[model samples]
Target: MRLPRSLVGWFYVSPLMLVLIPFFVLPMVVIITASVLEGDGFGGIMPFFTTQNYIDVFGSGLTFNLYFSTIKFTILTWVFSLIIGFWVAYFLVFHVKNQLLAIGLFLVCTVPFWTSNIIRMISWIPLLGKEGLVNMILQGLGIIDKPLEFLLFSDFAVVVAYVHQLTIFMIVPIFNSMARIDKRVVEAALDAGASRFDIMRYIIVPLSKSGMALGSIFVVSIVMGDFFVVRVMSGGGSASVVAALYEDISVLQYPPAAANAVVLVLVVMLMIGLILRTVDIRREIAR
Candidate 1:
């Protein structure tokens, strides 16, 4: 009694639907419902439905500033992570001759994740702060008489934290994609007189697009949804959409917080959709 192909396909997809329903769909539905309801000003929601929450979010100039700050961080983090991750993966896959040593080095990069992220972020202060190692070293080198105030508790620190934490996301996917490439193809290209640069540009890069897209999706989603890192790293000097949402929640403004959350989810979905249109990540990952 063999099952039909469609039935097998449905069975495979059923588990995914189960997870999505409980975790993703239900939460989004609750948020949407909350976004439309009126807040009772006492940390509770009223039964009445209203659009005022969204109206308030849309009307505020601070909303624009929040999103702008978030987008700026998102772009910067994505660019730096992609560049560093891609090259590091490339080096591991191509340059390192010993497989054991290559994997050991790769695992070394992941040592940061063993500790709490808050601990890691705080640890940077001793190395990047005004009187930290960086300032001491520079002063010893006669580079400057004053410490670099912008190194910590600023935009630079925020970006450094983001890249440090999230570059692993990019590296993993890109490494997977690059690892599956057939070295025979490179040998063939070389046998045909193709230079290393030509092979990389024409063959390696084109084939790695799917991995790049997947990595981009992960980087964008994490950075866009984060509030804590931006808040702590920036010393409250910067703000994000989620940070604004957090502020509303702290004040017991449930409706406004829900509205902000819904908008951010929609925008993130649109960005992911755009990335998916360029590559079939599901098939690529399966391969």
Candidate 2:
């Protein structure tokens, strides 16, 4: 006996739904419900529904600053990651003479991920801090009169840490996409008197849009949802939306935190929607 096609489709999808319903759907529903509810000025929530939480979110001046800072870091991280990742992937896929060596180098790049993220970030402090290796080197070389205060616990350090952590996200997807390209197509273009720049512009970039979009989603979502990185790296000097939510939760302001979370989800969804419009990810993956 054969199942109906729609039924067969559902069979394949059921396992995903099992995970999504309990973890994704239920949590989102709870958050949405909590966002409109009142907080009891303690660790518990009240049953009363109100829009004041959202009102507070929009009305506060700090919200604007938090968003601005987060967005600034996100853009910087994205641009740097894309540039470095694309070049690295291009070189590994196209220029590297020995495939084994290229794979080894790629693995070397990913060695940092083997350690905990907190450990990796903490390690950077010793390299970037006032009394850190970088400062000592510069001082020894007489390159500076004193340690640069802005190198470690400032916006610069935050951006550096973000780029360091997120570049791998950009690289993996792009490498996969580029590796899938038919080398014959590139050779054909080359034979047609096409410049390397033209091939990259018209062929590589267009083909890799899907990978870039996927990588962008990962970077944006992680950065937007992160509180600890900004808090720890910036040393209380900068903030993000999630960091603000963390502060609210610490103060027993559940409704406000929930409201902030809801708005952030909406914003992220909007950004992802815009990105999806540029590429048919399913079709690309199938190809």
Candidate 3:
């Protein structure tokens, strides 16, 4: 059943396959080798393989602490991002009739991405600093005589950074999902005396599950893998999972660093697997 035309298809696709095998696959093999073997600080690989990395991943007490902290942030960020993103997306789909205005709104959501994350983080300093705008305003308003010490280096700062950076990622997916939903369904729901809440709860949410799943996964993964959010926003006094991994690497603990990285990967994968299992992601994807 094969055609001569298929030969041309293979010939064109062969280059990408060649590139993938060498760059992507080869680097993965090197990472696995390095993760298994001990590495000298100067890049020499020792000739031994052990499960100590894997063991340390599970056994280290602080690893669990980092893991738990990251999970806490991931869950919180996901919920908040979804709620905010969904609202933004809904407004774009249902409320905004002017396409130019909608585009402007989306651009508003996207402005943060144009700035470097480090720069964006540094920008927060002025607002949250001791004599920054918020502090100055509060002091002037007689709300407090002293600057608030609760602004930066806190979970609030972490969440603020996470939501700021990742909201667009969540919004785009949810917005795409919302745009694809059938208008007739909403109209039908309304014509049948269904309230706005009913349209959202019964029809909209069910159809948007795929987008929610995608957005949730992205938000959780980004938030979990992040350190800079906690660093700049939290004033380097706090550590998320990636920050914890960086701490291990900073001290030249290769085995522990590798172990920590592997553990982070596993935890992320486990969460993704759990989501896929619960959602039957294959079905949603097929749609």
lDDT scores for all predictions? 0.91, 0.89, 0.79
The numbered model that scores best in lDDT is 1
Question: Cα RMSD (Å) between model 3 and the true structure?
Answer: 2.8
Query: Per-candidate TM vs. native?
Result: 0.94, 0.96, 0.87
The lowest-lDDT stretch of 10 consecutive residues in candidate 2 is: 113-122
Ranking by TM-score: 2, 1, 3
Better of 2 and 3 by lDDT: 2
Cα lDDT of model 2 overall?
0.89
> Is 2 or 3 the stronger prediction by TM-score?
2
Question: Model 2, range 1-287, lDDT digits (tens) per residue?
Answer: 99999999999999999999999999999999999998888978899989999999899998888889888888888889889988988898889979899889888888887778887777799999999999999999999989999999898889888888988998888888988989899999999999999999999998888889888888888887888889999999999999888888889898889999999999889878888899898888788
Clashing residue pairs in all predictions, respectively, total 0, 0, 0
Lowest summed lDDT window (length 10), candidate 3: 38-47
What tens digits encode model 1's per-residue C-alpha lDDT throughout 1-287? 99999999999999999999999989889999999999998789998989999999899998889989999999999999999999999999888979899889888877776778888888898999999999999999999999999999899999999999889888888888888889899999999999999999998998888988999999999999999999988999998999989888899999999999998998899988988999998899888
Q: Of the pair 1 and 2, which is ahead by TM-score?
A: 2
Model 1: lDDT equals 0.91
Report the lDDT tens digits of candidate 3 across residue range 1-287.
Answer: 76699798989999998999899777656666667787666545677887767776777787788778888888888888889998999898778988788878888888877879777766777887787898999999999999998787678877877887788888887777787888888898899999988888999888877778888888878887888788777776667888977876777766657666766777788988776665766766676
Q: List candidate 3 stretches off by more than 4 Å.
A: 1-23, 39-43, 278-287
